[model samples]
Target: MTTATRSTGDDERSAGNDDRPAGRAGARGVLSAYLALTKPRVIELLLITTIPAMFLAERGIPSLLLVLVTLVGGAMAAGSANTLNCVADSDIDAVMDRTKSRPLVSYRVPRTHALVFGVVLSVASFAVLWAGANLLAAALALSATLFYVFIYTLVLKRRTSQNIVWGGAAGCMPVLVGWAAVSGTVEWPAVVMFAVVFLWTPPHFWSLAMKYRADYERAGVPMLPVVATPRQVSARILVYTWATVASTLLLIPVTSWIYVGCAVVIGAAFLVMAQRLHQGVRRGRGVNPMRLFHLSNSYLSVLFLALAVDAAIGLPVLG
Candidate 1:
C-alpha cells in the first residue's frame, strides 16, 4: 500500500466536494467531505501492511473474525490521524495546489467539527481494538494516531526537511498492531517488517515531493526536494531503497526460500528503478521520479504479500 505512499504523513490526498448547498444536498456534500478527511486511500495502504503481518505472526491464516475486527480498528485509527492532520495543515493546504480543495481549505468542513470527529474516531478505534482484538493492539493503534497527529503534524512537518523520515514511524505501527493481534506481543519479524516500511517511506514521499516541489516551496513546508537539489534527493532515495531491500531480506531467517526468491526478484526491480531515478537526476535530463514513487507502493505490497504467502505455506528456510 505504500500509501499510503498513501500519504507522506506531511501531505494527505485531497478530495473535496463543492460547498454552497443546503438541505439534503448539503447533508450529502458534508458526508462526502468528512469521508475525504479520513483519507480512505491512506487507510487502505496501512491495511496492506496489517493483514500480512497477522499472517506472518500466525504462521498461517489468523481467525477471520479477528482479521475483520482488527481491520476496522486500524482503519479508524488511520482515519483519526489523517483527519487531525488535515485540521493541522489546512493553512498549508490552502497554499498547495494539490491540497487546495481539501475540505478544510475549501470550507466544506469546519475545523472544530473535524477536530471532534478525529477525537471520536480515535476513541472508537481504541474501544474496538480492546474489545475485539486485545489491549496491546488497542494501545498501539491509539498511540499511532496520537503520533501522527502530534509529532508529524504539529512538531516536525513544517520545521524540517526530514519530516517524513521520522513521521513515517506512525505508519509502521500497523505491523505491530497486526502482529500483536495475533501473538499478543511484538517480536523480531514484526520489527523487521516495521523497518521495511520505515526505510521505504522517504523515497516514496520524496519522489512525490519532487513532482510537487513548487507546491511545497510555495507552501513553505521544507520537504527535502523543496530544500535540496534533485541529485541529493535522488541520492538519498537510492540509499533508502537499498536499505528497504536489505530489510526485506532480514526476514529470511524466519521465512522460506520462496520469500527469499521473491525478495531477490522484486528487490532487484526496486533497486534498478531507484538507480535509474538517481542516474536520471544526475544526468540533468528530464527525470520522472514519480515512476519510482508508484513502484514503491507495489514494492511494499508485494514484499508483504510474499511474507504472508510464505508463512501460510509453512515452508521454512531456517530450522
Candidate 2:
C-alpha cells in the first residue's frame, strides 16, 4: 500500500510539472493580447513627438525624473485611447484584411476585458501625470483620449472622407502635454510643434490609406483613397507634406541653426519623396504607396530626433 501511494504521488507531481509550461504560455498570450490592443507602433510615434517636445520646451535636457514620469503617464494615456479605438472598430476590423488579425477581431481578447483595461490605463495615466508632472498635463492627456475615442472613432470616422484630417488633432496633443509638463503652460513654440504634427498627419496617414485603399473600401470606411483617385490623394499628400515642412520651418525663428539645417535638408528629402509619389500616381505608374508611407515614418522620426539633439547641444540663434 505504501509503495502504491508513493508511485501515485510521483505521477501527480509529474503531471503538475508538465502543466507549468502550458500555464506560462497562457499567461504570455494574455499579456501579448493586451499589449496588442494598445497599438504599440502608434504609441511609439506619440512618444517620439512627446519626449522631443519636452526637450524643446526646456531648450535642453529636462529633468530625468520628470521625463520618466511624463513618458510613463503619456504612454498609458495613448494606450488607453488605442485600446478603446480597437474596441470601437472591432466590427470593421474583422472585415478588413489589414486589421483582421487584431486581438479583438481575432477574439483573442473579450470586449469587456479590453474596455476595463483601457479605463484602468486611463485612470492610471491621469494619476501618474497629476502626481509626477502636473494637473495640466494630466488634463491634456485625458482630453486627447476623449477626442480620439469620441470624435475620431465615433462621429467622424464613419461620417466623412475627411475623417483622418480632423481626427488627427488627437495625435497632436502629446506636444501640448509635454510642454505643459515642463512649463505648466502652452506657448508659441508648442503651438508650432502641434501644427507640424497636424500637417504631417494627413500625408502620413493618407499614404497608408492609399496602400490599404481596398481594405478601407471593403469595410465601407471612406478613407481619402477610397473616395478619390490615387492622383488626387497623392496631390493632397504632397500639399500636406509641404505644409508640414513649412510648419517645421516656423520653429527656426525660435530655434538653432542645427534645427534650421535639419529642417531644410530633411524637408527637401521629404518633398522629393512626396513629389515622386505625386508624379508616379499622376502618370499611372505602379508606385507602391508604402514607399512614401515608410519614408514619412523616417521623416518624422529623424526630424524630431534633430529637435532633441539641437535642444541639447546646438546653439540657439535667437538667444
Candidate 3:
C-alpha cells in the first residue's frame, strides 16, 4: 500500500478505538443515570420495611413469588415516583449540591423523557402487582406512588415544614402493601409495622435535612431544618426517636421475643445516637448529627433484618 494510504488507515483505526471507549463510557453513563432515577437507597429501605411486615403478617414462609412480585412492583413504583420528583424538582435540585447531578436536574435526561418513563413505570408497576400479586396490594402501591409524587413532591415539599411529617405516610404504606400482597388483608400487626416506619421517617429525614439546611434555604423549600432553629430540629429528632423506640417495642406483642430483644438493643442504640445528636446540635457542633443520620439508616435496616431472620428461623414471633 502507498505510505499515505497506510497513514490514513492507521489514523482511522486509532480514531475507531478512541470512539469505542467514548461510546462505552456514554452507554455506562446512561445506565448509571437511569439507576439513579430509581433511587435505589430509598427503595432498599422501603423493601426492608416490606419484608418485616410480611413476616409479621404471616408467621410462616410467605409465597416467594408474591414477595418477588411485590418487591419488583414496589421498586418500579418507587423509581417512578422518584423520577417524577426529580422532574418536578429539577429547578430546585439544580441548586442543591446533593441533587445537582441528578439526570433531570443536569439535563442528562430530558424532562419530557423522564416524565414518560415515570408514567410508564408507574402504570406497569400497578398492573404487575394487580396481576402477579393482588388487587389490594396493587392499589396500595399506586396510592403510595401518587402520594409521594403529588402530595409530597409537588405539594407539601415546597410549601410546608411539616412536609416529612405528613409526607411520611407515603413511605409507610409499603408495609400495608406487602402484607396485603401475601394475606390479601390488613390487620393490626400490619398497622404496627406501618406505624414503626411512619414514625421512623421524620427523624431519619430530619437528620439529613439538618445537614443540608443551607441548601434547602437556598432552594426555598421549607424543610424542618430550614424553618426550625437547630435546637428545635434536634429536640424534634429526639422526640421522634423516642417514639420510634416505643413503636419498636410494641411489635413485641405481635412478633417473637427474639425480635423484641433485637428491637430493644437496636432501639437503645438508636436512642443513644439520637441523644448525642441532640446534644451536639445544642452545643453548636454539627458533625455528630451527620453521624447520627448515617447510623439511623443502618439502624432501621439491621432492626428489620433481625425480624426477618427471626421469622425465617421459625421463632414464635406471631404466636
Candidate 4:
C-alpha cells in the first residue's frame, strides 16, 4: 500500500513538472498575441500626430508628465480601436495574404478573449485620459475609437469606393485630442492639422491598396485602386498630394518662418513624388506605388517634426 501511494505521488509530481513549461509557453503566447492585436505600428503613427499637436498647442513642448500621460492614453485608445477592428475584419483578414497571419487569423487568441481585452483597454484609455488630462481629451479619445469602429470599420469600408476619404476623419481625432489636452479646446491650427492628415490618408492608403489591389479585390473592399484604373487612381493621388502641400502652406501664417521653409521644401518633394507617380501611371512605365507610399510616411513624420521644431525656436513668418 505504501509503495503504491509513493508511485502515484511521483506520477503527480512528473505531471506538474511537465505542465509548468506548457503553462509558461502558453502565457508568453497569450501576451504576444494580445500585443499584436494592438497594432503597435499604427499606434506609433497616431501618436506622432498627437504629440506635435500638443507642441503646436503649447507653442513649445508641453510638460514631460503631460506628454507621457497623453501618449499612454492615445496608445491605449488606438490599440482598443485597432483590436476591435481586427475582430470585425477577421473574416476579410482570413482571405487576404497580407492579413492572413494576424493573431485572429492564426487563432493564437480567441475572438471572445480579444474582444474582452479590447474593451478593457478602451475603458482604461478613457479613465487615464480623464484622470491625467481632462474630460475633453478623454471624450475626444473615446470618440476616435467609436468612429473608427462604427463609421470606418462597419459602415464605410465595405460599401463605397470613397470609403477611406470619409472614414479617414477618425484618424484626424488624435490631433484634436492633443490640442484639447494642452489647451482644453480646439483651434484653427488644430483644424488645419486635421485637414492635412485627412488629405494625406487617401494617397497613403491608395499606394498600399495599389500594391495589394488583388488582396482588396479578393476581399471586396472597394479601395480606390480596386475600383479605378491605375491612371485614374494616380491622378486622384496627385490632386490630394497638391492639396496637402497647399494646406501645409496655410500653417505658415499660424506658425513661423522655420515651419514655412520646411513646409515649402517638404511639400515640393512630396508634390514631385506624386507627379512622378502620376506621369509613370499615365505612361505605363515603372511606377512603384510603394515608393510614394513610403515617402508619404517620411513626409508626415518630417513635417510634424518640423512643426515641433518651429514651435520651439522659429520666428514669425507673417511679420
RMSD per model, one decimal: 10.7, 3.4, 2.5, 4.2
Best by lDDT: 2
lDDT of 4 by residue, 246-268 (tens): 98887877688787888889999
- Clash count, candidate 1: 3
- Candidate 1, residues 13-104, lDDT tens digits: the string is 23222233445697898899999999998898899999999999998999999999999999999999999999999999999999999999
Q: Write the per-residue lDDT of candidate 2 for residues 5-74, one digit (tens) a residue.
A: 6787788887899899989999999999999999999999999999889998898899999999999999
Residue 132 in model 1: shift from native, Å? 0.6
Model 2 TM-score is: 0.95
Q: Point out where model 2 deviates above 4 Å.
A: 1-15
Scored by lDDT, model 2 comes in at 0.93
**What TM-score would every model get versus the actual structure?**
0.91, 0.95, 0.95, 0.92
Give the Å error, residue 22, model 4.
Answer: 5.7
Per-residue lDDT tens digits for candidate 3, residues 1-319, read: 6546678778889789899999999999988888888789998889888887787667766888878999999999888888888888999999999899898877788789889989999999999999998999999999998999889998899899999999999998889988898889999878887888888989999999988888999999999989889899989999999998898777776667778788888899999988888888778875556778888899889988887877777765444
The number of clashing residue pairs in each candidate reads: 3, 0, 2, 0
Query: Which model, 2 or 4, shows the larger TM-score?
Result: 2
| Model 2, residue pairs in steric clash | none
Task: Please report how far candidate 4 places residue 169 from its true position, in Å.
Answer: 0.8
